[model samples]
Target: MTVRPLNSVFIGGRQIGANCLRVLVDMDAPPQLVIPDPDDVGVDSWFESLVKVAKELSLPTLRGARVKDESAIKKIRALKPDIIFCIGSMQLIPKEVLAIPPLGVVNIHPALLPKYRGRYSTAHAIFNGEKETGATLHFMDERIDSGPIIMQEAFPIGNEDTARVVYDKFTEVGTALFKRFVESLKRGEEIASTPQDESKATYYPKGLPSGGKMDPSWDEVTKKRFVLAMTFPPFPMPDID
Candidate 1:
């Protein structure tokens, strides 16, 4: 069946990247940027970059507390559109925020969940030596990256792949999958969602910059594993301390 397009909210930092831009164009939706104020933790260029992407797409941008801003909530309510397309929205969207656009508050996550859940999924996957890794499109909940899964696709991890490369690949795959999900929703089709196994769900905190840096003082095997786990470009491993 042919799927209809939608009007969506693009919430994320790193909107300038190719993966995200392509998804924005394909959705063919009017977007709004939702970013945290500068005072918020984890607020940075990524958020600003996303707003820029929205502007390029001729979408509105909103910067305020995700939960406390009455104006922002009202603005979203007024839009009353089909779906919310959220990418790197670093903050945990509150339950109040989720209720605003319940049906359409969807997110593109960077890792296969029930496994790696956090801001650093790509790095975690590489460190774990998982044979396959991919992305997921799911409903946003009060919890972080822990909603019912709408869709996921996995790709083999190459021996030479780095955290940066994995991130790039996942973002590309995720955006495409999300576009399809939006289309399905617009057509009144039920997008499939799978409940993740809680026991299998593993959470990893943001690691040191050199996540897999080997200590010159460590054993050979430990060093090798570190080398393999942290070999990705653009993301340097911290020096062994």
Candidate 2:
């Protein structure tokens, strides 16, 4: 008997998003609809474009539709997907959108949830001198990165590793985790997840730190770590004086 692929709507952007989408296609379980980040165009030159990847694969795409918006929600609801996979986009998935998919909205976050629960997890991890950081696949709730985690895998952060390096590591580990999740669905295994410990949670606000300025008051080691955390090519390094 032939098994039917899961019906899914993909909401993603950036390199990791594109990579995850490719993984789905490779596994013969591509999403029914693709929603690339609205602001992704011309946002950055360094990362792969989800829009481009979707178009290249001839997958149906809806660009410029924010999930929080009623119109986008309606469009997604019409598809009647079993699940919604959201990755890489920083926009918060509202409860309205979250309720559309029966199985829940799955999100791939770059850091271990309840720890680095914000936009700049990799950078924050490096800046804080964390020896290891990891990726998380979780269900999306109203709060940012606060949902129960489906899967997580940690990897070491080297002393010489910068934010860019760690980010690549996240992409690798996170994408693999997502692929595993898809494979599980193919095998008809029930999803398993665990609620995060709120006491261990941490959050960082959106946008660059101190407007991307290096604090002169920081000691040599701190300054160095800060700079390392902020380093990514095709984007200017943090200003140091």
What is residue 106's positional error in candidate 1, in angstroms?
1.1
| Candidate 2 lDDT score at position 77 | 89
- lDDT of each structure? 0.64, 0.87
Candidate 1 lDDT, 1-241, residue by residue in tens: 6656565555555532324545656656445444433243432332235544445566555744563467766776777646665666555565666776646477778888867887678766776667688988888877778889989999888876776777778867876786676566657686678888899998877763244455578676555545656655555656656
Please give, for residues 1-241, the per-residue lDDT of candidate 2 as tens digits.
3455799999998688989999999989989999988886634467888888888899999888788888888999899999999988867788888998888999988888889998788898888889999999999998889999999999999998989999999999999999999888887777899999999999987765555678889899888788888997767875587
- Cα displacement (angstroms), candidate 2, residue 16, comes to 0.8
Show where candidate 1 strays beyond 4 Å: 1-5, 15-18, 21-24, 32-48, 63-68, 208-221, 228-236
Clashing pairs in 2: none
Indicate the residue-level lDDT of 16 in model 1: 25
Instruction: Tell me the lDDT of candidate 2.
Output: 0.87
